[model samples]
Target: MSKLFLLVFIALSQRVQSFGIGSTLYCYQCVSTQPGCSPFNWFWHWSQACPEDGDTCVKVIERKGASEVVTRDCLSALKGVRTDIPADHYEGCKPAAVDVKLGNYVFSSIKELDVKKDYYDETTFCFCSFDNRCNGSSSLKVNKSVMFSLTALFMVIHFLILR
Candidate 1:
């Protein structure tokens, strides 16, 4: 009987080990109209662990005029959303139109551009990363060479003007 119990215990332990711990992702919880937390404001106190079914961290942004409404949450792999179509339909991404006007000189527009286009639906920004605490902050990529050249050009112009 003791040997049988030991075998059963070992089997259960192995099953638990396979599942493992730290399977949850971290997300932020805040609102755009909540007093001190306004317009993409986030606090450490609002961070939370994702649900058992969630495997990725997500940040959703919707732009309204000059302010943006942001929501950080956890996401599952198979989730879908509807946009510019009927219900029960899912398009991973959609094309959008953008208009730009610079003073009275240039007025230009772009039509049908492929944006992030994910299951998050029609949003200004929808980002997803597969890791714990990945959604804690906004991610940006900058080219070091471009930045360095711009800086050097500005310094050269400044020196010429001062001389």
Candidate 2:
């Protein structure tokens, strides 16, 4: 009936509305390597570190031709590495170590400390309704109930009119 159609339309119009807000946090951890070393040269290359924590150190080596072997120190060379907490609640990157130097050539007679860097990133999302009246939890509940009632009333009216 016309009344039924009207009720259905009203009910459909009163739907649960939602919106979202998001934020992200980033952190970097640096692992120091010999000068001119590239983290990408290695299999896994990512950069990540704990913002609050200092930096992390990682050792790396480089291969030249087929026989030449090089050793070097890499600092926070990885990219998109994650060192954040509460893994499930948020998303972040994880860093890995990479050997950048190739061929055994000792710059100094003494062995230098090898180090790499790590980083962390975070993202968040908040969802809410568009209606100003549905700003808070209680408001949202009230709005939902009101919407349902209006839809039901409209449907009843439509049904009676059609009949």
Cα lDDT tens digits for candidate 1, 43-135: 433656666564555554655456665555555422453132222212122222222331235333432332323223345434444444445
Go through the candidates in order and give each one's C-alpha lDDT. 0.45, 0.31
What is the Cα-based lDDT of residue 51 in candidate 1?
64
Worst 10 residues of 1 by lDDT: 82-91
Query: Best-fitting candidate, measured by TM-score?
Result: 1
Give lDDT tens digits, candidate 2, residues 7-109. 6675556434322112211221222242222332322322232232222223222232443222221123322432221222222222222334422363543
Query: Which sections of candidate 1 miss by over 4 Å?
Result: 1-21, 35-44, 76-122, 138-163
- lDDT score of residue 10 within candidate 1: 54
- CA deviation > 4 Å runs, candidate 2: 1-85, 90-142
